[model samples]
Target chain A: MIDLELERFVYFADLFGIAIFSITGVLAARGKQIDLFGVMVLALATSLGGGTLRDLALNAHPLIWIADPLLLWAAIGAALLTFGYCRFWVLPRRALLVLDAAGLALFAIAGAEKAMALGFSPLIAVIMGISTGCAGGVIRDVLTGRIPGILQQDEFYATCALIGASFYVLLHGHLDANLLALSAMTLIFVIRLLAIYSGFRLPVFVVA
Target chain B: MIDLELERFVYFADLFGIAIFSITGVLAARGKQIDLFGVMVLALATSLGGGTLRDLALNAHPLIWIADPLLLWAAIGAALLTFGYCRFWVLPRRALLVLDAAGLALFAIAGAEKAMALGFSPLIAVIMGISTGCAGGVIRDVLTGRIPGILQQDEFYATCALIGASFYVLLHGHLDANLLALSAMTLIFVIRLLAIYSGFRLPVFVVA
Candidate 1:
């Protein structure tokens, strides 16, 4: 019973993540002067690109959206909603960041959990976690001809994901699966929020 | 016996295409100031990104590189050779362009053939063909913070690929497989060469 409840929570969180990322994707296309269809494509790319890449890398079949039409509908609907909302009011930057951190936490843990369920190695699980939470935004930025914030070594993006995924992988067999997922996600969300406020960055690697 | 020989021929052509793309990848990373490992990553991304993507989308297990170590070796070797050669002397621009056209032709047809063999529709096969022929370069360009030339409406890059793949799809049952692949590749290569020499431009779509 508890497992079922936690599973539903995770599923709902996943939907929220898709919506948040789609909103960010729609906003990212602001100066590009593309048509509505192009915006829709961009939004889908940003929300779904990460999971799609993860599924592909892992040979996870049917693709998430293809398997469940609701994911696609969520992404498209959120994109359209954001499009409409933005016409009247720009979303506050702080709110988006806070929501994004929550989304990232959910996405990272979900990716890690999926990989764990599939019997992948811990390292692979952690990497998938980072990619699932982060690759979409990278794709969105790169398509717009900008260096991605993650790759730019901007604060704690994939890094927080890495830690969250690692935490899940470490405690997975020891704790209840449902509780562990929430714990890991909470850890990531807290650290990411702290990173945002603290503004400390990891040392950037430069080629000599 | 004939089938085996043709299969071998295609396999060798795939290796050659990998080498060519790896060389181009090395050349593209000229000013990036990345280390040797970074160069190898770029080379692999350029050579394998498209096929890996196609396989995942189609639910093909065991990525091509994971299945055959030879492909990865080809990419690494070609990248190293290019890195050494460029340190001594630059490759002629004309030579690289001709080789790239040949490689593009092979990659596109190979992608289409794989999709067709899996029983996908002609349209899906064509899109896969374009992606296999072109996505690597886009990833490489995007990683380095440049909008890819393919996305820039540069030339008949994907256009030539689309025509070639369509040709193969249209005549698949009627023509011998080996002959069809070669013919389609030749058609793409010739038209790409023509596009380069004639400097014809596709109408760029711009929103008013």
Candidate 2:
């Protein structure tokens, strides 16, 4: 059973994650010829696709968005806000990357916790967490007709989520759940920030 | 409840659909410089992605591939065969199109029937059917770095699935299940073939 206090924290984290991811998706579509409907669809896909997949894989009923319409509204609101005020925001590339990392961290922890609460195995929970953190961006890239950075750049993005999820799963029973969740999210965010600044990347296989 | 005899027929059709979809996915990857593992992943995604999404949306537990491992093996086997013998097969473009249409028809009817069996509304059932018929191809196109043909070409491909699914949902209670399933499949297949041969397409939107 999830602690009511932790559940409340998670709810806020989820909303922030949705808004940030939606903003990133809208930014990605800046130069694309996508219209308003397309932008809204892309934003929703980027914000909710990961959680939806994780819920489906875990057999969680009534998908989260269906359960909480507010999440959908949050994503749509973010998209509209971004669409209208993008020029004014003028966020630097580094700022966009930071926001994306923050979203990834929140999603990774929340996904892992949800899976564990649902009684999934630790490995499955970790996979779900990593997928939740990365799949949305992949979907956004695909919709925008770009090779997904996860498949191409290998900038330790998914790896950070995987490590954080593993940390959460390993420490959850021994430590306080809320503390562990926060620490896991922080760990992922810092690691991703470092990887981005340091240009760290995984080695690619070269076919002989 | 699904009739045992009809279930058996649907099972075989599902396997054939998996194989054909896998082959098409592999063929799509031919010039993309993707490695064997990448090709296998793409094939599995294209073959099973649609049903997986449909099952998840309907809250079906033990996803179809998990309940039946043969579907996975069939898809993997088809991918391996295509990877090794694509050059030798020399399939005409027309034959490939026909095979894809057949897969779409089978998946559409089966998906709609399954949704109806699960007691979903007819509208939702038809949507599930259309999703199951077209989602795999969309995934394949996206993964291959091309815009989904369904979204762009409007060659009546998804429209055929929509019509057939509606037909199945509307007639299933009044007709024998097996007869309706076959009729729906034939309708989609014939319409798709005609669309292909006649170069039929929906008018593209022109932004003013």
- Measured by lDDT, the strongest candidate is 2
Per-residue lDDT of B1-208 in model 1, one digit per residue for the tens? 2466556656766788888888888877777898888888888898888788778787776877888899889999999998888899978877767877888898898888887887777766876787788777777887777766664445567778878999988998898888888899999999999989988656432322
DockQ of each: 0.13, 0.11
lDDT (0 to 1) per candidate:
0.80, 0.84
Q: Between which residue pairs do clashes occur in model 2?
A: none
C-alpha TM-scores of all predictions: 0.61, 0.62
Candidate 2 stretches greater than 4 Å from native: A1-9, A29-45, A52-90, A120-127, A142-148, A151-208, B1-45, B56-106, B116-131, B142-147, B150-208
The DockQ of predicted model 1 stands at: 0.13
Fnat values, one per model, are 0.19, 0.12
Lowest summed lDDT across 10 adjacent residues in model 1 chain A is found at A31-40
Compose the digit string of candidate 1's lDDT tens values, residues A1-208. 3457655766666787888888877777665554454566567778988888888788788777656668878998998887777767757777667877887898888787778778899999999999999988888887878778787667677899999999999887898878888889899999999999999689989899
Candidate 1 yields a Cα-based lDDT of: 0.80
List, residue by residue over A7-69, the lDDT tens digit for candidate 2. Answer: 877777788899999999988987788888899999999999989888877778788888999
